[model samples]
Target: MSRFLFVVLPVASHLNAPLAIGQALRAAGHEVAWCGPRTDLRPLIGPDATLYPTGKRYFRLDGETGMASVRTLWEGHVLPVNRFIRDAVDRAVADHRPDVVVVDQYALVGALAAHRHGVPWATFCVGALELTPPDLPGFGDHVRAQLGRVWAMTDLPVDDAIDLRFSPYLVLGLTSTALTGATPLPARCVLTGPALGHHPDAPAFDWAAWDPSRRHVLVTVGTMAEHLARDFYRRMMAATAALADRVQVVVTASPDVLPEPPAHVLAAPRVPVLELMPRLDAVVSHGGLGTITEALAHGVPVVVAPIRHDHPTVARQVTDAGAGTEVAFASATPADLTAALTAVLDDPGYREGARRVGESFAAAGGAAAAARHLAALAARPIEHCPSGTAALA
Candidate 1:
């Protein structure tokens, strides 16, 4: 049994995959220790795992300053939260001294902790990023090239986290079987599908549970969704009105970020999406990997509205798979939302595509696959494992 230290991002979506992997590891008789601000995740792991609750913010993307030396780990700007995690690592290293450290992709603090000691660290990618095909043309042609240089500028030992070479580095992406021309990794990369743990238990929607006849549409901006999408929500509300008699719409927004919702819409605070996804007919969401994965996992189609960051990339993948329609952010007016959503809901192709993706993800043996690879990763010398997880079982 390995003593595993799981460092998860505090963000709600990122936590699910780690918790799922941790639970499976514990069930296999391994000791799992979690470090993060985990009040929201207590229900997922319960008393089975040890908690380290490092009260770091996990950094926000929009407004941040300072930390010029340690910026690569972040996809966006954030200083205070990064500093909190940075300081926490110093303390964690002197104490637990875990054998294996599994972390979320954005949580580079794991790299710092693991590198300083000899602890094996692997980062799990729970989201999507658009990377220009590695072999394509010049460096300028690669969309993700600049992101790589930014990553290498940091003080972390594995500065160039994206280098396709082998010989031990931070961040081993635990991806799915899609393997669709993804980056070639020198070290082992585990293709561990959608991590499934506990779906939040919430009261049934009155429209879906009570009426049972009305098709339900669930609309949500994921975590950080509300921050970047207030205008989108207002327009979405107007679109929801258009579907009034046809579909019962439940819309969620950040508590303080947006104004009141329209009367026709069921305005909810951030609710557990797991509970909501199972009952809904379709989801109107930002193209965050977590939201898309959950929607697809339940065989629910999506109307993907992408704004910034990875949303555009995720929207494209879902669209490519025929699981949803991508209403470009610049054109996502209420009429556009209504029309795009209608296109997704009316088409049988969308539903079938969602189920196909969902079934494939379910068959990938998520938590088990992750546990197998992590256990193997801890046992083998870091350099022994090849990129793309060629050496991982």
Candidate 2:
């Protein structure tokens, strides 16, 4: 059996995919351990899993948008987090002596640490931000420049040819071409769909309360953006009220955000989202990649209102794939939301498109496929690995 160490980002959306993949690896007889903040990892990973804590640090990107958001991500979050956890990751490498390290794309320090230790590593693409389109040459260059700056911090010699954000041996993209369209990816990149796994801490949902007579829709902006979704939730409540006879709405938010709801609507701070997806006819989302992919994986159409970060890109992909429609997050009116939701629900074409994407996702094999690739990489010698020279140098 091989040993695998996962260096993860503290964010929930980013953490979920790798968690699923790690579980898959462990089920296949491999040992798995995690490196990240203890406060966040403890509850999610539960008591049995081994964890190397890096303490806690907060990284907020509340009001930023567009290029400013990108700048904040690299300068505000990535660089600082790398500096904070660099020593801890290095110590984990030295102590654990893992055969392979699985690094979140955003956690560049993991890749550097693995390279320094001559351990093979795989890049886990948890979101669509790193999957650059051919037209966006400038954006790609900017990403390289940011990564270059991070590379310069070490005494190690610079190799401009290698993009540390992506592994030369393996890159597990948690998406399919059905959603990503025809965008070209790295030769080593594997599209492993969405890793839909069980959340042990998920709240118990009242399955008996669901009304099967009417069509159901789930309205959520995901975990991180709840503070920014109050207005959007209000608009959704108003819009869905008009279709009370034909549709039932489920909103995932606290009572403070949406205090009162109509008889046909269900409001809760947390819901069994994956368990509930199969029953949903349509989903109204903030265009988070995880939510969007999960919705499509279950053949549920989406109405995307992008907020920030890589949301706009994922929203555009949904629209381009003919599986959903998009609305402006800040400016969309009740009428606009109602119309978009109506279109996805009423049109059979949207459902067909969603099913097509769902089939492709099934073919991609999700976490099992990711585990297979990681195992294959582990079996190979370090001399044959792409980042092998970095250790020797």
Candidate 3:
């Protein structure tokens, strides 16, 4: 049995995929440990896997939005922390020498540290936004320039042909082409679909309270977007209120973030999404890849309003797949949200499209496929693996 260490970003969406894959690997007889913020990972990965706490909590821009905030996050948080994360990875490697390292695409330091130690590492693409095809350039010039600074901090020389975020050994994409649409991928790229993870401990949902006659709709803006999307949440609440006669809404938000909802809406800080997804007819969210794909996995359509980050790309993919509609976060009114929700819940085509994507996800293999790929890489040497970099067209 081989030992595998996962270096993941502190974010929930990013951690969920690797954590699921790690659990699968362990179940398959391989020993696995996670390296990240312990507090953030413990609850998700569970006690079965060991944890190596590395680095401090990430800086969060709660009230920030748009491309400018995106840039600030990259420059102020990600870039500045590269060296610290690299040190942490080195320490983790020294403490427990794993046969291979599995890295979240957002955690560049993991890749660099693995390379420096001459250990094989696989890039786990949590979201499709990081997968840059020739048609879809990976990063803009400004972003690439910032990436160079990150590379400079590392001991290994930068390979222009390979994106640092993508592993030279393996690239495990967490979404299928059916939802993301067909795009050219490197030989090492393995599209394993979304690993929504096993949430067996998810709280029991109050199903009896929901009206059987009305369409059940879930409204959420994801973890990062929750702080940045108050306006969007307000609009959603109003829209859901307008559709009270036609639908019953469950809006996920903390009491501090959102006001008390009308009788038609259930405003909770958290909901067991996996359990609830199958029961819902539609989802309204910030177009986060995790939420979008999870909804699709359950054959439920979505109404996406992209706020920032990779949300726009994921939103476009949803619209292109005929699984949902996209609305501009800034300009979207209650009417727009109400109309979009009505269309998705009313139309059978959207549900069919979502089911199609769900089929693709099942066929692609979820956490099992990802674990299989990582297992294969573990047995092989880094030099024997195929690698490529993403280039902007």
Candidate 4:
């Protein structure tokens, strides 16, 4: 059995995909372990996972604007973490000596370490937007210029052609082409669909309590999104209250955000979204990739209010895919939300579109397909390492 080592960032969206794939690999009789900040993986990834702490956390933030935030992510978070994690992963490789290293796209440091060690590695593209579209003029050039600076800071070798963020062997994308548009992927990039991993701490709720008489809509801005969500959620709650007679809203937010929810609303810090998806008529969210795909996987349509980062792009994809609708997040009012929710619920086409996309996701093969691909890569013979770039002694 081959040993697989995963190096990932601690954010839920970044780490979740690899956790699911690793669990599948372990179940298939391979040894699996993770290297990252030890911020508790048991709740999301189960208790059997072996942890190797990297002694630092990936920076988490919200409520930031466009270009500035993008710059901050690369300058403040990505670059600094790359330097720290490269050494951590290199040490882990020397000690554990895993057969293959699975590297998160953001955690490019892991890829560098694996390359230095002459180990075969796969790139884990946690988000669909991680790849630069080949046809976009100047987009690829601009990103590579910045990435070169990051490589220099982290003391890693640079490849001039395509960004080294993608692995030469394979890049397993967590999303499918149906929702991400028909952009042609690099030859090594494989779409493994979304990773709807098992949630061990799933909260049990009274399903019987849900009012079958009215259409159910779930409102969420995701865990990290709450920082920018208070006003947005207030509008959502007000909108749901306006349609109280015909619609019921179940909101996933902190208690402090909405201590006194309106008559037709149920507010909680955490809701078992997967369990609730089957019964939900629609979802209202911040257009997070994980939430969007999760709702789609259950064949439920969405009403997205994109805030920042990849939100606007993902929201546009949803509209283009015919799975849902989008609204201006900052200016959205109760009336606007009410109208969007009504359209998503009242129009049968939205549900049909969601199901079509969901069907595509299933066909793409979720975690199991990713695991199979990783297993195949690990089974292949190890390639000869170039003489100069040997592992640090």
Q: Give the number of the best model, judged by lDDT.
A: 2
lDDT of 1 by residue, 1-393 (tens): 788888766677777788778878888888888777767556666756577767745444452112221232243432344456665664675478787777666565565566556566777777755221222234223324433533344454344433321224333343443423354543445455677775543434444333456677888877664666677777887887888777877777655655676555666665657777788889988777777887888889998877655566677778877889988655667888898888878999999989888877777777777887778777765532222222322
Q: What is the alpha-carbon RMSD of candidate 1 to the true structure?
A: 5.2
Judged by TM-score, which candidate is best?
2
**After superposing candidate 3, which stretches have Cα over 4 Å from the reference?**
62-69, 133-138, 200-208, 384-393
Compare candidates 1 and 3 on lDDT and give the better one. Answer: 3
Q: After superposing candidate 4, which stretches have Cα over 4 Å from the reference? A: 45-48, 58-62, 132-142, 204-209, 382-393
Per-candidate TM equals: 0.80, 0.93, 0.91, 0.91
Worst 10 residues of 2 by lDDT: 384-393
| lDDT, candidate 4, 1-393, per-residue tens | 889999888676676678778878877889988888876564665566677778776476745756555656666778778777777788887778888899888787787677777787888876555553323335455566667876675554564543557877778877788887777776588887787766666777756667889989999887777878888888888888878998888998787888788878877788887788889999998887888988898889999998766777788888998999999888988999989999999899999989988998899999888988888888776553543222211
> Considering only N, C-alpha and C atoms within 3 Å, which residue pairs clash in candidate 4?
none
Lowest-sum lDDT 10-residue window in model 4? 384-393
For model 3, residues 1-393, the per-residue Cα lDDT tens digits are: 899999977776676778778879988999998898877877777776688888565665645555565577678767866666778887787677898889877778887777666677888877655574212343466567877887898656776765677776789988889866666765578989888678644655666778888889998887776776677888887888887887899888888778777888877877898888888999988878888988998899998887766777788888989999988787888898889989999999999999999999999999999999889888764453223332212
For all candidates in order, the CA lDDT equals 0.65, 0.85, 0.79, 0.78
| Model 4 accuracy (lDDT, Cα) | 0.78
lDDT assessment of candidate 3: 0.79
Badly placed stretches (over 4 Å) of model 2 are 133-138, 384-393
Cα lDDT of model 2 overall?
A: 0.85
